[model samples]
Target chain A: MSKKELIVREEILGSNKKVAAEIRGKMEAAGVLVVNLLSSPGSGKTTLLERIVETLKPTHPLAVIEGDIETERDADRIRRKGVPAWQITTGGACHLEAKMVGKLLPEIPAETKFLFIENVGNLVCPAGYDLGENLRCVLLSAPEGDDKPKKYPKAFATADCLIITKSDLIPYLPFDLEKAGNEALDLNPRLRIFVTSALKGRGIAELARYFIESRVNMIQHQRHA
Target chain B: MHELSIVASLFEILEAKARENQATKIVRVRLKVGKLAGVVPEFLQTAFDSYKQDTIAAASHLEIEEVPLKVRCRKCTAEIEKEDFVLVCPSCGSTDLEILEGMELLLDKIDLEI
Candidate 1:
C-alpha cells in the first residue's frame, strides 16, 4: 500500500496534548489553580499580572510562567513583584506548548497556590494548546479594538473569563466596550467580564477577589471530594 | 507564524507514515483545517513550501480541507453551522451551545509512492 492510501489516524496536536494531560494531573494533585492568559502583544497582560502579583502578594502564593518569542523582560517585571517567575522563550515560535512547560516543572515549586502561564502574545496558535490550566483567561485591550472576538472567536469561545484591559484609555480610544463584551459573551455565554486598567489600579480589587474566590472554591471542592 | 511549527509536525508524521508503508516518497497529503483551528492556510502553504525541500515529501502536494464551525444549541437542541464566532442558536436565541465541529486540525490521509 502507498503511504498516501494508508490510514495515518494521528491526532493533529499529538504529543503536546499528552504532556498537557500530565501537567493537568500533577496540578490537580498539588492543589494548584492554573490560569493560562492569552492575548495579543501590548495587550497589557504582563502589566495586569505584575499588578496582580503586587497586590495579591502574601495573599496568594503566585507563580508565573512567562512565554515570549524572545526577551526576559516580562519575567523581570514579574520577579520585581517578589513572586517566582520562569520565562520560556519559544525561540521564534508563536505559542507555548505543554511540553515546553513540562521542561520547566523543576523550577516551579510544588506549593504554588496560583500558577499563571502567560502564553506568547498571539491570539491564534495559543488557543489550540492547553497547558493544563484550571481556567483560560483571554484579554482584549481597548487599543486592539472591539472586532477581536469576531476575528478570533475560538480564543474567546474557550475562555472562562474575558478581561478588557486599559479601560482608562477607553475614553481616548475608539474602543466599544459593550460590543467587545457582547461578542465575547455570544461565544461563551457564561464568560465573566471584567474591565480593568492595570496602570490606574482600576478593577484590580474586583479581579483579585475573583481570583481569590476561585482558588478558595477549588480548594473547598477538593477537600469535600 | 505558529504555522511553521504545525507544518514541522505534519512533516514528522508524514515521514513516519511513509516509512511504515515502506514507500519511497509521498505523493499527496490531505489535512482538515477547521475554521476554529486557528491555522492560516496561507502561512501553512508558505511554510510547507519552504520546509518540504530535501524531505520525503519534497514533491508531495498538500490538500487542505476546511471544516465549518457547527454547534448544537442546549436550549432548542438545534444544530446549526455558524460562520461567525457567535454562539447563539438560530432557531432560539439561547446562549448555551456545544461545539460540534470547527475546532479540529487533523491529518486525514496521505498518498504514498511505492
Candidate 2:
C-alpha cells in the first residue's frame, strides 16, 4: 500500500535467454548449424524453406521448426516436401521463444546437419530475441518494397543474411533491389543478401550451396576446436 | 503487438520478486525499453493495467525509461544516437556502423511494500 523501492534487477527476456543459451550449446555440441529465419507475414519464409529442402535433400540433412500463431499448416507444407519438420503454435504470441524451440529439438532427428527455425511471421519481436541460432536470416519480399530495411532496421540489424524473396516479381512491383541491399548492408555490413523466387527457382541453387558450405564449416570448426 | 503477452511475463517476474521479499504488494515497476525493442510503451501500459488486477502487482505503477538508439560508426569512430532506420555515420557519412544501445528491454528496478 506504500511506496517502496524494491530494486528488482532482471532482464526482460531473462528466462528466454537462459533457455536459448542452453539450446545453442546443445546444437553446437551436436554439430548442428541452427538458422533462425525471421520475416513478415507474406515474406515467403515457408515457400523458401520448401525450396531449400527440395534443393538440398540429397546433401545436407535438414529439419525445420515452423512457428506460427494459429496453425500447423506450415509444418505440414514442409513435411509434404519429404523432410522432417515440426510446428510450434505460439497460440497468441507474435514470436517464437527459445523454450518452444528447446522442446522440439528432441523430436528432430539427431542426424540433422542443418536446423532451420522458421520463426513466427513478424518483423519486430523475432528480431529482438535470439533463438540460439548460428545464423539469423531476415527475408524481404520484392512485393514488400525495398524500403523495408529502412522501416525495420532492427530486423535487418540482427540478420546474418538477408533474403529478398519473390525476385521474379521485381519487374512488376517497381522494387528498388539495390536500395534495399544497400539499406540492409548499412545496418549490418556482414549481412549476405540473396535474391530468389521459389516459383521461378532462381537463386535456389545458390542458397543451397551457401547452406552446404555452412554445414561443412560448422562441423569442421567443431572438429578442430 | 506482442507487448500484451510480454506484460504478462513482466508481471510474473514482479509477483515472484515481491513474494520472495515478503511484500504485500508492488508499488512501482521500473523498466528500460530500447528504441528498437518494438514495444510501444502506451500499449504495454494499457495491457499491464488491465492484466494486473487480482495479481500481486494490482496497485503497482509502471515507470518506463526509454533508451535511445546508439550506433557506433565504424568509419568515423564516433557514436551517435540513431533516430531513424538510416544506419549512417553522422560524422563521416559512412555506412559502416554497429548498434551500441536502444535494443534493450530490461526490468531495471521495482518498488514493493511489505
Q: Who wins the lDDT comparison?
A: 1
lDDT of 1 at A62: 73
Q: Which stretches of candidate 2 lie over 4 Å from their true place?
A: A1-4, A220-225, B74-76, B93-96
Please report the candidate that would top TM-score against the real structure: 2
lDDT per residue (tens digit) for residues A15-124 in model 2: 88888889988998888889999999988999999999888888778899999989889989988998988889988788998888988888878888889999999998
Worst 10 residues of 2 chain A by lDDT: A1-10
Task: Considering only chain B, report the TM-score of model 1.
Answer: 0.95
Relative to the true structure, how large is the alpha-carbon lDDT of every model?
A: 0.87, 0.86
Find the candidate with the highest DockQ and give its number: 1
For model 2, the DockQ equals 0.63
- The lowest-lDDT stretch of 10 consecutive residues in candidate 1 chain B is B12-21
The residue-by-residue lDDT of candidate 1 on B31-112, one tens digit each, is 8888888888888888988999999889988888889999998889989998787788889889888989888888998888
TM-score of chain A of each: 0.93, 0.94
